[model samples]
Target: MQNPKMLIVEDCPAQQLFAGQLLKQLKIQHISYASDGELALELLKQQRADVMLIDLEMPQMNGVELLRSIAKQQLCQAVIITSAKDPLLLNAVATMAEADGLQVLGSLAKPLNKELLSLCLSRRKAEVWPADFERKAPAFDQKLLRKAISEQLFSLCYQPIADMNSGQIIAVEALARWSQPELGMVRPDVFIAAAEQWGLINELTLLLLEQALQQLQQWHDLGVVVQLSFNLSPLSLSDVAFMQQLQHKVQQAGIKPELICFEVTETQDFTQLSAAIEALANLRLAGFGIAIDDYGTGFANAQQLSRIPATRLKLDRSLTDGVSERPQQRLVLENTIQLAHKLGLTLIAEGVEKLADAMVIKRCGINLVQGYLYHKPLTANDCTAVLCNSSEQQAAS
Candidate 1:
């Protein structure tokens, strides 16, 4: 992070000079400039920089194309997109770059302020966060997969979800982790998809559920009472009998039904609509909460979402990552929160890594937030230790 070198790709000489001056004031002397992304790409091939300043409206090659090439070629340490264009467009471009597994520092609107630029520069992550937990996962076989599930080798970690107004952790969402033999940790997306294809999702789901509920009971006994959100596969959600399996487990663990919330991703289309709805309704009837996860992204429209009887709505990270920088996006989030309130759903903004993001979500009148800003996914022992610390503090007070 020291003496951070940067590349500025801009067609306008005056704009480039202004950015250069800002960097110079910041003490970034090792800087280079190019009139277009093509030239910038060529410069990067010659020598890469710690960060690249990209202009969206370049002539020869656009910023988006340059981003794709950089990601494919592994050029530069990171990127900060500068455009006088609409902030919404900037957000979309940032999303595009992140989707390609390229780390984006921040999107700066035109006539950029020095302080904002400085803030973005200071956010250079030492180790890049994976683009939505995706990777080229190691190959898995059905035999090995089934053996892992049966042996309970697949593990669970909990990410704390905080109540922003109170700054207290109100809930935790359970995420699965798997360390395949010899191959190390396998990405959840890959192994989960494999489980679904191999017709073993139910087995895997029950395995994690049992573990989560047992952990929740331990936390409750420690007076670290917080809600537990567990993701359910559609394959398990459609089977009404799955409700009974969950209920029996809850009873055995002695965790109240009200403390458990089942989360279903809205990004994927619900093909088994009727059965899934029936299961959800029954679960709600039994006092278990339902949350529409990843609400803004994918196939779940308002009409479809409204039909599901959800008790909570999780705004997808796509909508919140740059919420503080994008006024229009904040307006959208505020209206979405309004809609969720009218339907009696508690709202949570996910992937809140910056204080600015938390401020914007707080301004939007949503209280709950979840992401690396608060905590990463942690193992049961690690999480329970945090709970113990909080409990001791409360007792001391």
Candidate 2:
């Protein structure tokens, strides 16, 4: 993304000044500001902005509401959602924006730093947006999605999670690969939002689960017994029947529920998703590992940890990526590690890409790790090869 015209929607004067300085340092000159979302919308009514930097904590029409309004009115093309809130909240908001067809550069947690801002800006690809242009909806034929779910057409890619000390693969997280005819490969966030919108998310999740559980059983059959973890959307967990089917599917696969972990986010809406939350608790009680995914991203904290029945805590990549270099990040990571330990939750540090950071995480006592450092998400067959190869090497060592 180029240095296109940008608008900042925020209420805090000091934070606004701070953002201005960072933008200045980056030489982002074509800038404007609105004290609140309402004003921002009004200003954007006349002139369009290439990018909108939003502060989520604004008084009237908070950043999230602003994003909704922008998406509804076609107010902006790209946005950088900023907040003092946790990174999970930012990620959730970003997903929402993307689902609504807004091009999200990424999210930033304030107080903002120039390095991150520059990196996020570099991710922007320069594109000309006509004033009359509207954000494109997530394009997928409902029939196609329904067919894909029913036939189990969607594929799973496995990314290995390892015990850092022994350098042994202990688990693999299943990520969905959705490739549609003609449209080619769709972004996971985009397609997932589509699934929810079309009310096919439950089917989509079950199909993936069936495939993943079967794969895990195959690996176990071959004498490689490692756990399997996969994401579950809040919407997918709303129905008690889906949870029942999930358990039945595991039993039918001849896989022990203990070897399976279901990962869920700190969902967007807490009020309406009480049943889904309860479903997760019940899943935990049923001998399935329930992981509070993305622990340090700002949402899962001391308060949330004590309440949820999570057996595992997977640190978000955002919280661990630069922990070795940044004092503040290290501070947060260290504290989170202690909290999870005191609560007796299994710990896994995600995004352990660097030797320095990996050493830091290892020293911090996070034995389970996942990231590109070990392996990227690969097809089941390819991943099987990688896992077998890893086993051979570990045995030799």
Return the top candidate by TM-score.
1
Clashing pairs in 2: 1-124, 1-125, 86-298, 87-297, 88-297
- Candidate 1 structure quality by residue, lDDT tens digits, 1-397: 6777799998899999999999888889899999998899889999988899889998989888888888877777588999998877988898888777767888998887789888888878766444533355438689999999989998899998877765667788999999976778888888998888788998899999988988898887777888899998877777767668878888888888899999987445367888888888988998999988888775655775568989999888877887887777788788888888888888888898889888989888888999998888888999888767765765676
Task: Report lDDT (CA) for all predictions.
Answer: 0.84, 0.82
Model 1: clashing residue pairs?
Answer: none
Pairing residues by index, what is the TM-score of model 2?
0.67
- Regions of model 1 farther than 4 Å from truth: 128-137, 391-397
lDDT of 2 by residue, 1-397 (tens): 4577889888998888888888988999988999998999999999999888899999878999999899878878788888888776777787678667787776888888899888767657666554334524666678877887777778999999988778889889999998877778877877788887788888888888988988988887776788899898767776889889989998898888899999987755344456866898889888899998877654555666866788999998767775665556677788988888998999998877777888888888888999988778899999898888877888799
- TM-score against native, each model: 0.90, 0.67
| Candidate 1, run of 10 with poorest lDDT | 129-138
